[model samples]
Target: MITLSESGVIEKIEQCSNLDSIASLEFYSGILAPAMVNAHAHLELSHLGGVVPPQCGFSKFAQCISKSRNLFSEDECHNAMDFYDSKMWDDGICAVGDISNGSGSFETKRASKINYHTFLELFGLKSCDKTRLNKLSVVASELGLSNSLTAHSTYSLNCKDFDDIVQSNVEGILSIHFMESEGERVLYDGFGELHSWYVECGMHIDFDKYDSPVDRVISTIPSSRRVLLIHNTVLLESEINSLKGHFGDNLTFVLCPRSNLNITGEKPNFRLFSESGCRIALGTDSMASNSSLSLIEEMKEIEGVPLATQLKWATECGAEALGVGDQYGRIEIGRRCGLVLLESVDLIEMKLTSLTSCRRII
Candidate 1:
């Protein structure tokens, strides 16, 4: 049996041999686990939940988000973020690495029960507003939230903007959308639908003499700080090797399979990631590309990974990547990491079935 203090910190853990005389002992039917950490999310876009169509491909999906994001009022967007913040709490997410383009979701996150590390994401084909990004980071800090100025994607940011973000990110985790679509590859090679779309929109992106996306990342981004590479949906074996060789254990590959499926009708090679000996974590990208911000639902999409390994990915790896391991990933003593009881699990096969659901227990 596990015991907790009134403030929710774990106190003691022991096997229950005889519990007839125990005082106020609570028994749960299903497996007990630590609350999960969402290593990547865009809480600022929660208002666009069902507005964007599913399986629309990355280029179309990007266009849809750009077009539909401003359709809602400020109040609607904040309310949606508030509602989803509570939903994620109810779904047993203890910590999150949330992305923000502005201060729209800041107040909600300031009042949230979940631990949030805000990533102020910047992106532009010509130049990005680093001053504005810094101002938002200051806003988050003033509200008593941890934050970092991050890049949106390898393909979105111009050379100067990308280099500025990397150089300015001295502390906290640096998150980037890495190789999530084929369009990203084509863009790097200076041709494809994404490239043509940029031209049609009256913009031409330059890769700044880089050989490949991975080369730009390796040559520019320093290995001194922690980095999270989100959405490796199109990562290749050679790219993985190069990244691991350069960043070593300081890099984490955060997978958002459900969101990938929703947008591109495809997913990363789970077996390849699992066998690559690289650090792996899990995330729910956003409601725009997913049905809900539920890690359980995300876990259901991981087909061949063992439930134990998936749990590690959802909890420990995520917490480590987000630098919140001391408080939110494990059930050890002294940690205030909340407990979650996963119900309807297929214990025999060590798998999470479609019926598996989770609730916060402590």
Candidate 2:
């Protein structure tokens, strides 16, 4: 059992019967582990929940979001943000690597108990004022939170915008939507639904200047640093090899399996990533594309993988990625890692069943 001071700071951890507590507590029969971390999320887009349909592909999903994103009032967005933030906390998530296009989440994060590292997102596909990034960066710094200026995705950033964001990403943590779709790379080759979608949307690009989407992005950023590559629904073995050559211990592939399924009806070739010995992590992209923001729901969508490995990805790897490695991710004493119960997960199959649910015990 864990002993928490009235102030919520961790006091001590000891065996249940041996521990003495002046306060009352609840107990349950389940496996206890460190609280989970969501490595990639979009709190700014929470207002767009269920505004887009599943299996429609990222291109169409982007189009629909573009059309309806601004329709919601600030109050509506704030409401969704509050609800989702509370939902993740109740689901045993202790930290999050959340993407924010504006300061919409700044106020909410200021009042939140969960550890948050806001990745101020810069998108070039449409347009973004590069100057605003420093302002947000300063604000995040003043608030005593970890923050990084990051890109929206491989496809959305043009050469100028990508370069600018890379220069500003000094904090070592770079979270990006890497190769979430083939269109990102295929648009360079001149034939794909994504290319067509881009043309129709008037976001045409000159792909002839670069080798491929992934290569172009890799070339622009730092070679040795923690780069949290998100989605990667179509990342290739060749690309993984290239990444390994440049980023040794600095690469982390943040998998959003359920969100990938919801948007594009596919998952990354996770076998290739695992076989390559790539550091893996888990995320709930957003409620905009996914039905649930539960990390357990994301794990349930993944099959043929060891549960322990994914659990490490969801907890340890995620904590490291968000710059909170010392504070959370393990059950060790003095870590302040909140305890959580994994209910009904089958150790034999290493698969999460419907009965499996995460309960916060601390």
Candidate 3:
């Protein structure tokens, strides 16, 4: 039984088979778990929903986003953000680790009932935005949200890009989109379509500048700090082994299966990551690249993993990634964690069937 105070903070927890002894308590037969967490999301991009084409390769998709991001008016984007926030809440997402290229989602986040950790995502094609992070941090702080200055991806961030970002978020949760597509292999030998596009756009870079894009990113961030590596679609097994040995305590992997399939028609090598026994989480990248910001679709699409493990990835691991484990991951005393009920799934067998759906309770 969960005892929630009037203000929604959990006061006590009783581990029992039933709460039948409690006075006038109505109970149902369902499996209770912590509310899900969309560990990596771009709520500000909600306005771009249904605009970008599906199954477009990463390079072309990036171009489409850049060209169409400013098509909507400011008011329209704000409305879309609010609507998307409600959709996540309706789907029982208690917390979100959302990425923000700018401070556009600040007001909606401030008014949201769900918990949010804002990531000020920085990017530069050939240079770094070394000076604008402090101002962005102030905006997040004023809105009363946990914020971090994070890198967008391994390809875009350069040596000069993270001077301010690394210092400001030295000890916070740092997230990066790492090797999300096969095209990212160009950084090593300049062979992929992404490299060809770079040359076409006149964005030249020395492929020999670093051993790998992952190495270049890891060197800039402190090893002691927690780093969430999002999108491991193209990372090699050898690279995973090396990083696991070096950054075990501070590394976590995040998968957005639906987004990956929607863009590249393939998902990450889940078996590879699962065998490593690394901490994992789930997310919906953005509406621009996905059908909707629902974590359920991601959970359903992710196969080869056990249902219990997938649920843990969607909830507890996500909470841990967002730095809210003690308060939001599990159903425990004094946690104040939101709760949801899993319906239609086989509780006895602990399996997720096609009929499975979630119902939010608290």
Candidate 4:
């Protein structure tokens, strides 16, 4: 039995054979594990649940999101954020990399029980402007959120916008959607089925106007800054190798398995990442594209791998990617005691059911 104080410190941990050994327990469950860290999620778009439009390609999905943005009301947005925050807490998410499109969810984050670093997302396809950048900085500072510039995706941003985001010089954590689908890779390489779709949508993208988006982004962004590259389903061997060489300990790949399957019907090459010495993490993404914000579900979807490795992706790797490793990832002395208790069982069953709701005692 272990007790976590109100300040998130571990007060006591006593080994026991039965439930009666612990005194005055408020919550009881099976096995106790360290609290989870969700590496990537867009909380601002929580209001658009169940609104994912059927799209054949990544470009079509982008267009659907663009069109659906206007349909949400301010109150609905607030309610959705609140609902999602509560859900995360109930599911034992101790820390999160929450992407905020605006300042509306600031209060919700401040009041939530979890430790959160909100990334203020910014994107402009054609050109960059200092005025807008300054305004975003001020808003970020006023809200007391971590200021991060995130490019929407490789295929979505122009070079000028990408450069402006990189030059913000407000460095802590950098995030970007990388190769999520084969179509995205093809579009960036200037030979995809979406070429006509881009034209039909009135987006005049001259593939010759810029270099490869992945290469260009990696070169422009500082290698020293800790990066969380999300949705790397189509990332090549060469790109992973380059990242390993340049950003030694500062790079992490965040896999959104549910979202990847939903959009592209494929999963990332976990074997390649495992063998390449690249750290990996997991995320639930936005409810708009995913069915829920449950890391347990994400874990189940990617089961059959070693249990220890999967747990590391959900806990330590996520903390490292979000720049909170020293404080929140592990269950060692001097670290915060953000923990989850699971239903007690034999070691084999415990490993298999640790992430399920039936096993959780947050």
Task: Please list the C-alpha lDDT of all candidates, in the order they appear.
Answer: 0.90, 0.82, 0.83, 0.74
lDDT (tens digit, per residue) of candidate 3 on 290-342: 99888877888877888878888989999998898988878877787788887
C-alpha TM-scores of all predictions: 0.97, 0.92, 0.93, 0.88
Give the top-scoring candidate (lDDT): 1
Compose the digit string of candidate 4's lDDT tens values, residues 179-296. Answer: 8877766676666756667666677554335456566666777787777889888888888998778878888999998887776677887777777788899999888788888787
Question: What lDDT score goes with residue 288 in model 4?
Answer: 73
Candidate 1 lowest-lDDT run of ten:
203-212
lDDT for 125 (candidate 1): 86
- Stretches off by above 4 angstroms in model 1 are 20-26
lDDT of 2 at 261: 87
* Residues 215-279, model 1: lDDT tens digits: 98998898786899999999999899999999999999999999999999999988888888998
User: Can you rank all candidates by TM-score, best first?
Assistant: 1, 3, 2, 4
Task: Pull out the clashing pairs in model 1.
Answer: none
* Predicted candidate 2 versus true structure: per-residue lDDT over 1-362, tens digit per residue: 56676655467777666334645755565567789999998877888877898789878888888789889889999999898888888899999999887788888887887899988888866677878987988888888867888877767778888877776556547888888877777788887888897777788665347888767766787775668889888888888888878887788889998888888888988677777787888999988898878998888877666788778888998998787889899876567778788988776765678889997877
Q: Determine the C-alpha RMSD for candidate 1 after optimal superposition of all C-alphas.
A: 1.3
lDDT of 4: 0.74
Name the regions of candidate 4 deviating beyond 4 angstroms.
1-3, 11-29, 54-56, 127-130, 206-211, 343-346, 349-355, 358-362
Q: How well does model 2 score by local distance difference test? A: 0.82
Candidate 2 regions exceeding 4 Å error are 1-27, 347-350
